[model samples]
Target: MAYVDSADRGRIRLRRSSLICPGDDTKLLGKMETVAADVCIVDWEDGVVPARKEEARRLTAEALQKAWRCPERVIRTNGMDSDLFETDVFAAVAAGVDSIMLPKVENAEQIIEANLLIDRAEQAAGREAGTVEVWALAETVQSVQNADAIAEVPRVTCLIFGGGDLGADLRLKRIQLGSNRTLGIHRYEYFYAYSRMITAARAAGIDIQVTGFTSYTDLDASREDAEISAQFGATGALAISPRQLPIYNEVFGPGADDLVWADKVLAAVDAAAAEQRAVVVVDGSMVDGPFIRNARFLRSLQDLIDAHDGSVG
Candidate 1:
């Protein structure tokens, strides 16, 4: 249920932008340092063909062993039901990745089994048993249905929403919404999926990450998608390209307007404290305990992001 401190060069971990790459792509793997992301996830599933899985695993192991600039390093292993899942977990754990992302997870039992395997991997590598973390993706109907239970699983720190496979699973068609725009491969169709994942992760006291906007070439589209995600309470987003990182970071992190609001709230709260008042009104709106707490949380999140960006040199 608890974790130990790892011995690697740790940075302040944030989840604004996570860059996903195939494990076997030597070019992308080599360019990891140059990518702009808060986290780097090397993939072992979908990214590689069946024939090259073993090769990808070996290369992925090597990539994990090598140092990268990301504060959090993650490995996305094959599904829990796959025969190769054990090998993927064992190799990733031995290589010292910060998290092991369990894909296509349907329920807590898979996470429980995966946790046992991760514990063994950690022990086998002579590291503290709970140091490596577990991340689960809500990619299927079953997964989305059981998201809350999965998030409540011990050591499952973050929950991700994968729309690609999910769309396929649901047989989701490109339906036209009010704007007359068909739900083209953008991160827009699954509003229900987003809400469920967000609520589940938050309810379980964990972070939530949305899959990247597939329209990588369209920065405006990415920004719009990121705004939608942030508006819906997503803490972070995945990025298929380095170009999407800035948009995600900007949209998700506190902006100038948010900072201004936070400052105003803090000022009002401080004034309220001076008057020995438990609640206050700001901008003609009620500011209570919960509202003040949210303002403080945003300020703290901004502070953390600033500190990490400062240390990125």
Candidate 2:
């Protein structure tokens, strides 16, 4: 039996929505506190212009200090090789943010280096050790290739896919419809990269998030993408706008049928246990280890939903 530790259990109790707000947008930052996202990410990588980097960092730091009740705060720093990388780390730590997101990571060494910076910054800020967590953005082919190594970093709590940058890196054009137009002709072999990252995160026992659709106006598109990622074992999806929050929350969360099945399975298990039996039958099918594991997971999800007041349903 796979036992969920206190941290993983706590994570399961929280909402799954991770909302991405531009670091420079203080108005959105203020409004986000009222939103239902479990994690709030202030993006400094692709969201800010080169000239506005400093301003965005300042605003993000200020928001972190002023915001009274952000559930989980994350700062998406510039890429590892960027000129602003060090500054981003220092600012995020000094601002007392919860986590720092390292974008465009290519391997485990980069994660180690980033963790070192975070450790030093936390010490300087008089914060306790491991006060901050690290989030790795697997955005390149090299990064995906080394996904397991990166995910194994002790400081890493979650991993996310940066789809737009990844798509550009693979030189594969986006297909609007469900069909994979690029896969039919183009030999760029990065389509399976997303699944590889998920597998790595699962192996490391960390939460994995998938990039949300950029088209926020279309709820259907966002919901479809959320469903696909959820099916692929992603715990959640990033929301670019507040409008997409409800959709992501709904799609990633446990559904009505899930609750029903969980209840039935637990009932059967309880009955079997009373009879001194190790197995039971539910819905005309023999239920055993895997079924019990899934039921426990569903119970955990329900417990999480009950604990958080921001659940969409």
Task: State which candidate has the highest lDDT.
Answer: 1
Q: TM-score: which candidate is best?
A: 1
When superposed on Cα atoms, how far off is each prediction in RMSD? 3.7, 4.2
Weakest 10 consecutive residues of candidate 2 by summed lDDT: 178-187
State TM-scores per candidate: 0.90, 0.88
Off by over 4 Å in 1: 1-13, 174-188
Write one digit per residue (lDDT tens) for candidate 2, span 1-313. Answer: 1222436523552437788878888898787667778788888988888988999988877777765433678899988898889888888899988888888889999888877888788888888877688888887888888999998887787888877677777776563222233343222343497679989988887888877766677677678767877888888888877888888778888888998999999999999999999879989999989889889898888777766655443
Q: Scored by CA lDDT, what does every candidate get?
A: 0.82, 0.78
Model 1: how far residue 116 lies from native, Å: 0.4
- Flag regions of model 2 displaced more than 4 Å: 1-15, 66-70, 174-191, 310-313
